[model samples]
Target: MFRNNNLSVCWRLVRREFRFHKGRNLMAVLSVALTMALFTVLSVIIQSLVGSVRDYCIHDMHATEEMYRQFLVSQLPELFPYFLSFIPVFVCGFLIIYNIFRIGVDADIRFYGKLITLGMTPRQVRVIWYGLALAVCGLGIPAGAALGIGGAVVFEHEILNFSKIPIGMIVSLKAIAAAGVLSLLTVFVSSFRPARITAGISPALAVRYMELSGFERKKEKNKFFPISIGTGNQVGEDDRKKRITPRRMAVYHLARSKRRTAVVIASLSLAFILLSCVYVQYISADHDIYLHFITFSDYTLSVEGAGADGANISRDLEPSLIRQVEALPGVSRKGALYKQEEWLDLGEHVYSRLTNYFESEGGWRLREMESDVYWTKAYENMRKNHTCIGMVYGIDSSYTELLARPEQLIDGTFDAELFAFGAYAIAEGVEGGGGQPNYQVGEQVEIGGRTFEIMALSIAPAYLRADNDSAESAFSLGLFIPEKSFRQLYPQRGIRELHLNVEEEERARVDRWLADYQNTKDPFLDIRSREALKETFDQQIRSGAAVGALMALTFGVIGIFNLANTLIAGLLSRSQEFAACLKLGMSDRQLLYMMIWEGVCEIGLVLAVVYPLALLAAGPGMYLYLTKVSNLWAYQYRFSIWPLLICTPIMLVAAAGIPFLCYRIIKRQSDTSMDPERPGAWS
Candidate 1:
């Protein structure tokens, strides 16, 4: 009977609060909906992209079907970005929900005091508040989930409207469930603090609840001082001046409700900080990073891998085709890395290390190395006389530029003129943890039974270098020498690969031309271009931007919504105080000034808090993007304040406008309007 009575009272109290505070409850529902919707939309989009990554790992990275499942588990970098978004989501959600609940608690202090007088326990009060959040989540989550799935489809087509990257919408039950769980957790966490405040209120203190102020501040007595520490100074009432103004009152209101103001300020600051961080990340993710790191040219045509039928660059990539490509209407500059496979006896020590690398790294792939006859022959040779098979790529001055580029250089020097006169170099793998160089700079190594001076140790970027096993390993011991010398080495051979840049407008024409030529004349020729690679990189950047935009939109709107909620809560809770001020000669315009000052105060605190913290977060955020997450070696950390600057003005306008407008609406609805200039108003 006792338990039933407590339950009945809790339900009635919860229902009354819900009915009385319709606007506040409405805002709460919207906030919860927005939070879940952002989470759902982001999850769907992220899952779709992760699917794309899985396909790439399976088809491109050559991970087998069984290994693919294990690969996602072992290498989950694909999920890191999606998980990273939770920080802002939870933060924004907590602050907004917490501020709303705190205001509700302040407003209900008297009602709670009466409930305590009726023998209700603090535990029951806390449960009431928790139930309050539960009520709103019921209405919010489903609506948000449905809109979120729709948003996923809309955002997909939106991305395709601007970018070449295909982003298909994927609606995952797992993702929706996750969003729901997180949304509930956010509410539960946010409600805990406010519930505690509700539970801690003293019935006696609550009975005297007056202003927005919760706790009683200790009064400090004023002390008077005389000039020059002399007792002869006399206190005189020369003039009586009223010092307290609307601006001062606004400050007092904010100071009294410190917790509510702090939550509001923190929500706004975090939104700005997160927006700036995403902007920093987007800036760091430049497509040029990939372009410069790969080849820097617009297009590449390679026949190096067409050795499947024993047909190679020497046999199929004719010189006449190179001339015709160059003579095309839009061809700018041309470059090529001509290649012919050669084996070198780089001594016993180097051969031993190469053997270890092949065994350790090769695992199972090298044993099934039947890609072509050339690799098989090379592997067989390496097993025999400690010989390592590698390509002798003859590069012109243009290809030599790749050799000496700061990003590509491992060691040594290359002068195109010197290289033209038979200066040769050993090519090392740029990124791998392979063993030390087989031949040092300036050291002489024999290839083709001919000795040549090693000019530099550099990695050949792009398609010229291929993974090697016990066989034709371009990664382990490739050779680069001048083109003229390479012609002498293999006079009748054709160019290995042709790399060229074309005018931006004529790329389509050139692409069509290359496609037709490859389909008709030489079907085995490999064609790659900067534009194709660019779409991949751009997709990464644009996808992130779209996701970031969704999150930013959520945070931005919620922060403002939270601010409005807090302000209205304050205004409504302290209506008696404002009425007293009006009765004491405070004018309508003065009330407007007070609210404007409150808005200014909020924006001021946000600016003071946001920029310094954003700098700290953005630096680490930028570092993680460049060094830890991204594959772009050319992206350098460069800090810019433009993102913050762009976001600040808008925040300022919203902050100031919300309070000022809120006051006008609240004032207009008043049943009785007091005139400050009325006789005896001061009394």
Candidate 2:
């Protein structure tokens, strides 16, 4: 009997609310729509991008597979420590997306209180509005996701292709199911706050703002226009000229509900802004990086080889094999450069406990000695003239361009004179030194147990790695010499490694072409291409993205709940205004129509402000990061429409439904509000 009476009372009160504040109820509904639309537009875009990140990075790159199988095996101890660095980015992304969702819900709560004042019982009012909000939110989320995902997917695919690596992507049904259940769960939880607020308010309070009853705050009237007159206006009708224009009304209403508006817009705007910024930055960075890599001095395919210890590949393999690799498709300028390690012997007093002294009486050190090796540049710090010896590479004139060291000239030019006398291109600061000053390009120096003219100084552009500790770092600090100089200096010493450059685009093809040569008599040759190296690099990026996305989703849940709560609370607050209309003889159907209209208006307003800005902000940055910075060669940044088209309706309906349902419940319980005193003091 109690339950039945409560139901009857609730219906009666909702009917009364419908009668009293029809126009305001309409506005309240629109508020739900607006917020939902905003939520939908932003969330879809962000979620889609995030989803693409997961798909392309984890599935396409197979980052985990490569890490465990290849790179991590040799450095297991360092691997675990390195994996710990990706925590912050994920945490931040989740916070941003979740906050945007919350803002949408908060706007609903802001208008809910007014609906309560229209005679609708709190319980009934909550049901109607909560339903409205849910419907709008439901429509918006998917649309936004679609829009964001569409563009992201295309770019992601391009990135994968450009990297020339494949990944094994698995679609986890469990994860999808979990996402679905969780989203529904969020909707359920978000609806409760407004329900609680509605149930707690008294019927009397529902007739007007019970929360503000004690305050008699006076608002200053705007009188910006003193004597404005229109063609149809008369002096006697001056007071009526204070009508609010729709745009002004919207702004005025939002301002008047400053606290709620601030909560909603600020949260939503932040989400939109953050997602846009991150997407833009990441894509832009990638694009920039790729463009830079393509700008190398030579459109040359790089050949990296590991040879039998102390064996020179160029000397071991027939020149015919080198020609074979160079003949591959897109093979452009082809040349071989020497790479090898050599022991250093320092003369007596010049070498302290830190240095090992070796017998330098022989013109050359034996191959395979493990004496400590140091760059010539390090000698300056020793402050003493010391006889030290390390191996040198002999190179042809073309080798200078291959090493990207055309600037290694000091006193002499790179002309035939320097190339003829076995000219050596030592590093910038190293030359013959005793009590004498450092040698210039014109002088001859005793290096690698040979006398060679300092024909040029190698001022090459050194390579850099993400972390300064990569292989290129070591190479940057090494010395260079012409090929003739090495043979003249150490006629008996052997070559160590040989590097070949092919057409830049044919690095892989050249590698394949060399496969036959590698299989034949030459067990000492090991050829590697830049494409393979790039594959490894791409894998690293995908691994990072995977780690980042997981963490982002975790924190995003909290934000989503907070934002949803805020929105529900605001929408429920409008119940009083809805109830007032019902009491004043407005039809239930009419009230519903007005509420629907309001939801549409509010959603439209939010979309109007958010979508384009989100697009504008995210576009250039995303293009730059993906194509240039990340060096995702295949990525193309384009404005995507799918997320917008898809998420818009879902969010709008979810946003609209939350409040509509709450209001309907109030209508069902319209009678409960008839006896104002019985409903308690706040009412």
The most accurate candidate by lDDT is 1
The collision pairs in model 1 are: 314-494
lDDT of each: 0.71, 0.43
lDDT by residue (1-683, candidate 2, tens digit) is: 12222455554544554445443333333333323222332233333333444454344333343332333244344334223422232233333333333333343344445544444455666655455435534554354334334433443433232222242222233333333333434444544655675556554544454222243223323532243322245445555566323233334334344444434444444445444544433342343344334323222322234333321123333555556655667655434445433433343432542232212324122111211122222343232434332334555565566344443333445555545555455543322222112345565555655555555554333221111112212212234676666566555644333345555566555565566655775654545445554555455455444323323332233233333443444445567765664454445565565555544555566567667766766676565655566534434565444434544676577556755775566655655665554322112
Kindly provide the TM-score of model 1 when superposed on the true structure, using C-alpha atoms. Answer: 0.80
Q: Write the per-residue lDDT of candidate 1 for residues 304-400, one digit (tens) a residue.
A: 3433332332333677778888888889766876666776766776666666655666543354333334555666677776766656777788877
Could you say which candidate leads in TM-score? 1
